[model samples]
Target: MAHLGESIDVDNIVPERGDFEALPAGPYMVQITDSDVAETKAGTGLILKLTMEVMDGPFANRKLWTNLNFRNPNATAQRIAQEQIKQICDAVGFQGQLTDSEVLHFRPMRVQLVVKRDEQYGDRNEVKKYSALNGSAPPANKPQPQPAAQKPASSAAQRPASGGQTRPWGNRAA
Candidate 1:
């Protein structure tokens, strides 16, 4: 056992636990915050684990996770994983070769998520698809035209600054 160096004040702290409920099924804008390459359960394959965070809306900052079996013992699983990787690259407009997963990090993209319930592991969100945040890739190092003096119609009218830069929440601050 370990002893505390100082006295504690439990009464002043909030007692509520964090909500673990699965997010409702739908498309969400997110960015890959982290990625890792690890061995599969059987120890015969490798998987790319990606951790993403919602960028906007009420669920902003919520985390979502997915694993791609890039080097699996099963041929079908490996093929599917490879295809998913390709789709992610295409969505982010990553051309040429991709040797590191970190290249995909911090790029905002849209993901279709569905809730899957398991008796043993509880419910979790599964990534169905990956796409560019907008219909097309964001401008890469190109200058954005300044809006006219007139007020913009809505939030949708706002655009990120040049160099494909965007705030962590996937929007430019007012």
Candidate 2:
């Protein structure tokens, strides 16, 4: 162990509460920060685990996880995963075959968050939907403009200045 020059007070350090609280579910500007293919909990199939970070809004810097089971023994699960993957690809304007590296690349996109309730685990955030930033359907053949590598701005800066309203919980009207 290295010697300290001065005595430090451990009690003076304040723990950050945000790290423990669940982010209120709602639409957020997010980016894919990390991803990997891993075996399912049951050890029966593979899943693509995505770690997404909220780039803006009230819950900026918070993380939300999403798993896509593209290689499952169950046909329905595979189909649903494929569909969701297609939707994500379209939203991000990615063309051609999907690869693990490409999917892991950092890309900003809009995601709708929803609360999923479990009897044992309580409530958790889930991705409800995805959309292009321009509020229009992604072109079938054309690729959307990609932003350069840089720090993402807050949702207030990215979204329209006027209609900046956000509903954290669910779609229950404010």
Candidate 3:
């Protein structure tokens, strides 16, 4: 969540209001977040690059940040990223953060955030907007990536090579 600073300098402050048409309209799941970039991509069949910055929050001069996840590996992630970025920037309280890199990274601050779809949009009955009374993690978008598989351990032991078999099973300790 982004917020105003305790001693904000609105004189030097200017809210971000840029135009982008690279993405389509749909839902986006923010994964990781930072100040430099918004690594967002298509989800719910949309394509776009969503970026943002400073917005009024609990404190002042603060902004909310989030990295988008399409939750659809089959779809073009970048396209969805572009579209999502467009929607997010246009959405209320989404004071677009400017960054050269596509990845999201940023400073800490309060925010009027709407990263989660249900919390922002209520078209879907299953998903719900935020409950300000209860500050908690938003609904999850995708499943976690599974870990890699491992090989099994051997059960047999090594045998002696000097000239004879110490035992039928294996070697006998000297």
* Backbone Cα, N, C clashes tallied per candidate: 0, 0, 46
TM-score of 2: 0.67
Q: Write the per-residue lDDT of candidate 3 for residues 85-140, one digit (tens) a residue.
A: 54433322123232333322232222233323354433221111212112332212
Worst 10 residues of 1 by lDDT: 165-174
Candidate that would win on lDDT: 1
Q: Write the per-residue lDDT of candidate 1 for residues 7-66, one digit (tens) a residue.
A: 799889986534567899999999899999999988999999999899999999998889
> Which residue runs does candidate 3 get wrong by more than 4 Å?
1-54, 69-73, 76-79, 88-174
Q: In candidate 1, which residue ranges exceed 4 Å CA deviation?
A: 7-19, 138-174
- Ranked by lDDT, the better of candidates 1 and 3 is 1
RMSD of each: 9.2, 14.1, 21.5
Which of 1 and 2 is the better model by lDDT? 1
What is the alpha-carbon lDDT of model 3 when measured against the actual structure? 0.32
Q: For candidate 2, which ten residues in a row score worst on lDDT?
A: 165-174
Candidate number achieving the greatest TM-score relative to the actual structure = 1
Q: Kindly list the per-residue Cα lDDT of model 2 for residues 1-174, writing each as its tens digit.
A: 999999999889988866545567677888788888899899999898888888877778888888989889999998888787776776676655565434424667888888877778667788878776666555443333447664356533443333434322111111
